[model samples]
Target: MRSLAYVAISVQLFVGLQCQSLPAKVKKCHYGDGKCLVESANALLRNFPKGIPEVNLKPFNVLPVRDWLLVNDSQVGGAWYFFELLNQINYGFENTTITEIRGFDKDPTATRIEIHGKIPRLVYKGDYLAKGRMLWFVDINSHGTSESDFLNFRFDLTLKVRIEYRNNKRYLKIYELVPNIRLDRWIMWLDNFFPDNEDLTIAINNLFNRNWVEFWNELEPGILSLFETVFLSLFEDLFEKVPYDDLFLADEDSK
Candidate 1:
C-alpha cells in the first residue's frame, strides 16, 4: 500500500510540473498530431486584432484613378493630368471588427482562411487640383474648387485568403474579399461646391443613389488592393512580435 501511494503522488507531481512549463498566454495542446499547430494558429489569430493599432500604413494614393467616372483621357483631349488630382487621393480603412475567424486546418496543404467582419468606414478627406472638363459637364477648374471633402461609409466584408510559408516567412495572397456596401448613415460632404443648396445636394445624393452599384464596382479594385497591402503587412509584423516557439510549444510526439 505504501509503494502504490508513492507512485500516485509522483504521477501527480509530474503532471503539475508539465502544466506549469507552458507559457500562460498560450494554451498547450497535449493530444493528437497537428493539434498543437492548429491551436497555435488559432492563438495567433485571436491575438491578431489586438495588433491593429500597430499596423500603420503609408497613405494609399492612386493617380488618375482608372476608369474614374467612366471618363477617358482621350475624350478630354489628353487634359486628364490637370483633372488627375481630383482622382489622385489618399485613403485608409478603420474600425475593423472581426466577427469570425477560421481555417487553421490540420492538413498541411490546406491554405485557405476565411474571415468575416465589418469595416465601419473608409475615409477620404483631402485636397486635389483639377482643371475642369467643360465637355464632360464638369465646369469647375481651379486649385481649391474640388478640394476639402470627406466620405464615411460601412461594409460587411468577408475575406477568403490564401497563405504560403516559404523560407520561414509567411505570405498571404488574397483569394477573394467581397464587401457588401451598407447604407447605414453614409456621410458625404463637398465643402465649397454645394454646401448651402438643399435641392442641389439632394440631387447629387440622388445621383449616387441611382448609380451606387456602378460606384461600388468602380471602387472595388482599389479598395481591395489597399486592404491586402494593410493586412499582409499587419500579419508579417504580428509574426515578428510573436515568437514561433511560444506559439507552437508542444511535446515531441504531438509534432
Candidate 2:
C-alpha cells in the first residue's frame, strides 16, 4: 500500500510539472554586471528548494545518494582507511548565500564563470561502513548508521560552458564544473562501531568527533568530486530548458 501511494504521488508530481509555465520570478541579469549576477544567484537559490517545475526540476532541499566510497591508500597518522556511505540524504543547500561573483565581466565571449557561496549548515544522515589499520597493529572495521553536521560550509565554483544552437535558439552547456569546498567545523555521530563493545564504540565516536578536521582533510577530495557531480547535473538540467537569452540580458536589453 505504501509503495502504491508513493507511485501515485510521483505520477501526480510529473503531471503537475508538465502543466506548469516558466517561472515568472526569475530575474534575468545583465551579462557583465557582477552585483546583478550575485542577486540573481541568490534568488535562484531561494527558489531551488521548491523546484522550477517548468524545467522539470524537483525539490533540492533534500538530496538522496545511493552510495559513495572513499579509499585512501596513503597513510594518515600511520593509518589508511576505506570509508563508504550508503543510502545518504543531505540537506540544507537551499539556504546558501552567494557572497561574490567573479569572472562575469571578462570578455563577452569568454566561457568561464566563477561563483563563491556559503551555507550556514548542512546535515547528512546515512549508513557508513569503514575499515582501516592503524599503526600497523590495530585493525578497525565498522558498519552502522551515522549523522554528520557541517557548519559554515563554503564553496568556490568554476564553470566552463559552451554555446549550443538548438532550434534557432542559443543555450549554454556546462562542459566542466570544479568545486572547492570547506567547513568551519564538523560534528559526527556513528552507532555500532564495535558491536560487541559498547564502551569501545563510544570512545571511537568521541575520537572522531574531537578530531573531525583531520578526517575532513582526508575526505575533502572525495567530497568535492561528489559535489561536482551533483551540481553539474543540476546545472545541466536548468541550462537545457532555459535559453541563454532568457537567463542573461543583452547590452541593449539591459538598458
lDDT of 1 by residue, 1-255 (tens): 999999999988755433222235546444222444444435544554333333221222221222223122443552342332244343333244455544534331254444444544445444444344544554544333232222334444445655555334343444565555443333444334344565764575567656656765665565455444444544444334332232343456343
Candidate 1 TM-score, C-alpha based? 0.45
lDDT for model 2: 0.78
Q: Candidate 2, residues 27-64: lDDT per residue as tens digits?
A: 77777678988988888888668677677565668877
Pairs of residues clashing in candidate 2: none
The per-candidate count of clashes, in order, stands at 0, 0
In model 2, which runs have C-alpha deviations exceeding 4 angstroms?
1-21, 72-80, 103-111, 135-139
**Clash pairs, model 1 backbone:** none
Location of the lowest summed lDDT over 10 successive residues in candidate 2: 103-112
- Lowest lDDT sum, 10 consecutive residues, model 1, at 55-64
Candidate with best lDDT: 2
